[model samples]
Target: MTNISGALVSLALVIGIGIWGYKLLVRDVSGIPVVRAASGEMRVRPEEPGGELARHQGLSVNAVAAEGVAAKPADRLILAPKPLDLTEDDHVTPAAMVATAQQDQAAPAPVDQTEIAEALETGNVEELVAQLTAGVAPIAETEAEVEKVVATVAETVAAEVSAAERQVAALLDAPGVRHSVRPRIRPAIPAEVTQAALTAETPQSVEVDPASLPAGTRLAQLGAFDSPEVARQQWDQLMTRFDAYLADKKRIVQEARSGGRTFYRLRAMGFEDIADARRFCSALVAENQDCIPVVTR
Candidate 1:
C-alpha cells in the first residue's frame, strides 16, 4: 500500500510539472482563437451584430406560391349536378343511339316496347344484347394458326425421337468390335498327370480303424459332437491345427448315448494304454486343448 501511494504521488507530481511547463513555455496550440500581441490594430474579435436584427432573414428555401386561395365550404360541398348527364350515363342503348347518330341517320326506326320486352325476356337476352352490341366488332380468332404451328412442332419432335431410336438401335446392332479375332485355348492336362501332381502337392492322409487297435488300447476323446460326420470333421480340423502333436494319432468317431441325447465322441485312437493316452492328453492340455482319456471297454 505504501509503495502504491508513493508511485501515485510521483505520477501526479510529474503530470503537474509537465502541465506547468506546457503552459509556461509552449504557445497555445488548441483550436481556441488567440489574439496575438503583434496585431496591434485588431482589438476584440470584430464585434458581432448586438442582438438579433429587427427582422431575421434566414436561409432561403423553395416555398409554395402564395396565390392559391382557401376554398369556400359551399364550393367544397359537391352539388347534385345538372341531372341531364345522369340519364345519359345510367343507360347505354339511348347513349349508343345518340353516339352513332351518323350511322343511324338512315337506319334504326323506333322499336316497340312490348316487342322489345318480349324479344329480350324470351328465356334469353340474345336479341336485345345483339341489338346493343351490333356496332362493336369482335376480335378475330388469331390462335388457330398458332395451334397449327404447335401441331407441326409436335410431329417434328416425334419424328426426331423415332430417328434417334433407330440410330441408337443401329449402333447397338452393329458387328462386334473384335469380330475377326480368334481366342487360343490352353490344352488340358491328362487325368493321370493331374492326379500325380496333386498327390505330390498334398499327400493322402492314412485312414485308421478303431477296431484294429490292441485290446488294452486307450483313446483320448477330443470333444463330443452331435454326429459322427461332425466328429470326423473336428478330428480333421484338430489334426490340421496341432499337426506336430496329433499327426501320428488315429482318429475315431465313436457314437454314444446317455438317455435320449445320442452323440458321437471324436477320439484319438492307437494309444498303447491309459498311461500313453494320459501323456498325450497332458501334452494337448498344456497347449490349452480339451482332452479326456477313456478306456475302450
Candidate 2:
C-alpha cells in the first residue's frame, strides 16, 4: 500500500513538472524582441551609411558645401582657441622612483645615535646599555650567581639529553627502525663555460659613481653568464641584434660570485642617465629580451 502511494505521488510530481515546463517554454510575452523575431514579425533596421545611402535618405548631408557655403579653416579657428604645435621631441618621461631620480620617497627609519652618544659621554652606562639592548636589564653584580645559573642549565640539559637518548634507543630497537645510514650528499659540479673563461681573470666589482661618467650617462646590465667569455659573447650578440639602439653604447662585463661559483654580468654603458638606460631596457624587453638598469651613487 505504501509503494502504491509513493508511485501516485511520483506520478503527480511528473505531471506538475510537465505543466510548469510547458508554460515556461511555450508561453511568451509579445513585448520581447527575441519572441517577436521567432514569430517572423521583427524588422532588421540597417545602420545609416555616411556615403551614397545618405543622399538616398532624402537629405543631402553636404548641401551646405554643395551650395558653396563652406567656411574657411581660419574662420572656424576664430571661435576656437588656437592649438599649440607639439611634436614627439617635446615629450619627456618622468623619473618614477628608479633610485637615481630621488623621487617618491618614504619616511626613513629613525635612529638615536646622538642620544646614545650623549648618554655614553655623560658616563651613564646603564641608560646606554638599556637603549642598545632594547631595555634588557643587566645582571646584578652583587652576587656570584653566574656559576649557579650555569650549573642549573647544565643539569637540565643533561637530564633532557639522557631522556632523548633512551627514547632514541627504544625507537632504534623497534622493528620499523632501519639500522643502515644513507651516504652523505656531495656538491654538484658547476656549469661548463668557454675555454678562455678558465684562464681569464675576472674583474672585481666596484661601485661606480654617477658623476664619474659624462653628464647624461647611465649603465644597463643585459645578462648574467657562467663566465666572462660567455658574458662577452652575449654582449657581442646583443650589439649585432640591437645595433640601432646600442650603437653608441660601450660593452661592460662585471664579475660576481655566489655559492662558490663565479658569474659575469654583461652590461652596456652610454645611456643618457638612468632614465635613458631604463627606456633602452624597455625597448629590449618589448623584443623578448631581459634587461636591468644599473644603479650608481
Candidate 3:
C-alpha cells in the first residue's frame, strides 16, 4: 500500500510540471515585442534581454511598433572601410606609361569649332587649301627636267631624220624601175586661155552622170585653181582644217573647160545628199571659210 502512494505522488508531480510548461509555451505573450531584421529573421527587441550576451550587445531599447513588428529606432550600423590614399610607392610600369603616352599621341588634337564655323561663314577657302596641302609636297616639272626631255626628243628626231636621209640616198643609189619612169604629160593650153582661166570668176554649168544625179546629188566646190599644184596645196589645207569631216572622203582637182578657158576645180566629192553638203559648207562658213554647195545636173 505504501508503494502505491509513492507512485501516485510521482504521477501528480509530472502532471503539474506538464500543465505549467503548456501555460508558458502555448499562452500568448502579446506584451513582449519581437524585432525583425532586413534578412527576415525574428530577433528579440533590444529592450528584452533574453540572454546575458544580448544585453552586452549594447542595443538601444527605444523602438517603434510597425505592423506588429518592432523596428529599432537606431539599429547597429555598419560602414565599409575607407580606401587608402595613393602614395609614391604605388608605381606605374614603363610599358603602362608607354601605352598611355602612345594613346595620347594617337588621339587627334582638339579642333576649335568656333574658328571652323567662322572660317566657313567667311568662305575662307585659302585656309582649307592650306590645311589640305599642309604636309604634301608640290608637284612641279623642273626647268632642268624639261630641258632634258626636249634634248631627248631632239636627239630622237635628229636620229630619225638621219635614218630617212640614209634611206633616200640608198634608194637613189639603187638601180630600180622608178629611175627609168617618165613624168606625166601636161595638157598644152594657150597662154591666153590659161590667163583667162586664172581670171575666171563666174560659175560654170557642167554636165554630170545620170546615176550621180540621184535625189541627194550635191557637190562641195572649194575653188577654181589656176594650176594643179595650187589646187593640191589648198586640198592639203582643207584636209588639215576639216580632218574629222574629211575622213574616208574623196578629194579631187579636176580640169574643166568653160569658154576656151581651162581651170582646175578643187572639190570634196561623194557627198550622199544636198543636206550633208550644206551642213559641211555651213560648218566651214562658221569658221570664216568660204565654201559652196553646187547642185549636180
Give the per-residue Cα lDDT of candidate 3 at 269.
Answer: 69
TM-scores, all models, native as reference:
0.30, 0.29, 0.27
CA-only RMSD, every prediction:
35.9, 35.9, 47.1
**Candidate closest to the true structure, highest lDDT:** 1
Q: Model 2, which residues run further than 4 Å from truth?
A: 1-217
- Report the lDDT of model 1 for residue 238: 75
lDDT of 2 by residue, 127-182 (tens): 66655555333457314455655566677678878999999988988897467787
Clashes of each: 0, 0, 0
lDDT of 3 by residue, 164-259 (tens): 999999888888654666766665554554443463222221233334444545778889988978987787777777767666556666678899
Model 3: runs farther than 4 Å from truth? 1-216
Whole-model Cα lDDT of every candidate shown, in order: 0.68, 0.67, 0.67
lDDT of 1 by residue, 199-261 (tens): 222223465666665565688889998987887777767776687877677677767799898
